[model samples]
Target: MRIGILTSGGDCPGLNAVIRGAVLNGIKSHDFSFVGFRDGWRGVKEGDIFELPRHQVRGIAKQGGTILGTSRTNPFDGENGGPERIQATLDRLGVDAVIAIGGEGTLAGAKRLTDAGLKIVGVPKTIDNDLDATDYTFGFDTANQIAVEAIDRLRTTGESHHRCMVAEVMGRDVGWIALHAGMASGAHAILIPEVPTSMEQIFGWVREAHDRGRAPLVVVSEGFVPEGADAAFSSRGVDSFGRPRLGGIGEVLAPLIEENTGIETRATVLGHIQRGGVPTAFDRVLATRLGMAAVESVAARQWGTMVSLHGTQIHRVPLRAALDNLKRVPAERYAEARILFG
Candidate 1:
């Protein structure tokens, strides 16, 4: 069987591990020939691909990012869009199945292709850990660990300068990254997009920390916004794909907290830093498991299904379950962090 693979959406730490695991396992066990798409769905539509073999995947487990590359190209737009072109390309290449590794947008496009009669298997990939149905995605642990280290480093500077530090991490609608990292780093306050915060409440936390003679460390997700506030703080504008350009939330929150509480404040946007670098051992293992399971899905001819991490093992779930709703930070989890907030 000729199988095609592509990585899409934002880059993450464990992407290459997934690709490597799939290629090695699939070739050894299933004897499936593989082709790697150059960039997400665009590669599928344009038939931009390279032959993948076991030798090509050697020594990539610890690497970050996808060797096949990625992009946010939404194939659902305009006439002669991705679905039609993808079908044509598959026919031309004689590929029997596709393995899509990406976040929500990528899965949605793959689902559409499946509905249009293509055999597709998905592997969830996101630093945010927001995809439903999966207990945890590949890069979330690594990204959170990276964010925790950044906050730990900032703590020393914040204490020395007697300033309130606001560190922004990644998350669009979910706060999994902020919540986990904040808890790990002992942040004084953690903010997320799931819970809209007011300027008054924020200042209160900073003031309380200041009164205690300790610099306040606030961790926020890039998608976090103040209630009744403009969205530009989190996004520059819409892209060609119509999704907001998410970044700069810490900058916006920093000044507001300073003005409200009269405490010296700073903001550190850990933008792409969280997505780059070597993945944690945890991430490498999980990504490898997901990739191997994804190959099994192909061998089993399971279309419109994705490999998911459920507790101790990798499980196969319907694509609709993974993409139906974002798995957000639950109230209980947020409340646990709230217990330590100043």
Candidate 2:
């Protein structure tokens, strides 16, 4: 059977690994031929694609980004777009199935196409680990690991200058990246999008940390909203998919923190750095397994389903399961981390 694969949304650490895994598994086990769509849904809509043979995927497991490339292409745009157009394109190309590797928006679009009678399987690819169905996603570990290393490096500089360093990481609607990285880096405080943190509380934490003869370190998600503030200012703009850009929270918070606490504060936004790099060993393994499971789903014709990691095993679930709700940091988990706060 011939299959088509597309990677969508933002670039991720383990995206190349997933492509490699799928190509290797599908060819070796199922004797399947593969074609890759360029630049996400736009490629499918425009019929822009090329063959993705097994050799084309070699030595890419540790590579960052994707060989097929990606984009925030809206599948609902243009006169010749949406589910009907996509279905016709797949059928015309003689492709038997599709494997969509992306985050929530990409998966939702693919699900719509699937519901319209197209054969497709999904692989959850949120770097924030926000998808609720799976225990984890591939890029989150690599991103968190990168953030932790940056925090560790910044801690020394902050100590030398006696400054309260605020490190910002990505987490659009959740705090998984900040939470894990903060805990690992021994951050004095962690601010996330899910919790509305007040400037006064931030000041208290910095003051307490300073009194203990240590340079305070703060880790916050880019989407963090300060209490009684207008969501830490407006976003830059929306993407092609109409999702708002989430950032500048750290930059806005740092000044307020310094003014209120009388401490030198500096904000460092770790933008894009966390998302680009060789993936961690954990991420490589998980992404590979998820990719292989996606192939299995296609063989079973499990339309509108996605491969998910439940504990140590990979399983397939309905697309709705993955999109039911975002997996935000729970109160209890936050409380446990909060106890270590000032």
Most accurate candidate by lDDT = 2
lDDT of 2 by residue, 1-342 (tens): 999999999889999888888988999999999999999988989888999998899999899999898998888789769888888888888888999999999999888888888888999997899997999999999999999999999999999999999999999889999999999998999999899987788889899999999999999998888888665454688767566777888888889889988899999999899989899999999999888889988888899999999999998899988888999999999999998886
Cα miss at 6, model 2 (Å)? Answer: 0.3
Name the top TM-score candidate.
Answer: 2
- What stretches of model 1 exceed 4 Å from their correct place? 78-80, 230-232
Global lDDT of model 2: 0.90
Pull out the clashing pairs in model 2. none
What lDDT is reached at residue 230 by model 1? 64
The Cα error of candidate 2 at residue 307, in Å, is 0.4
- The TM-score measured for candidate 1 stands at 0.97
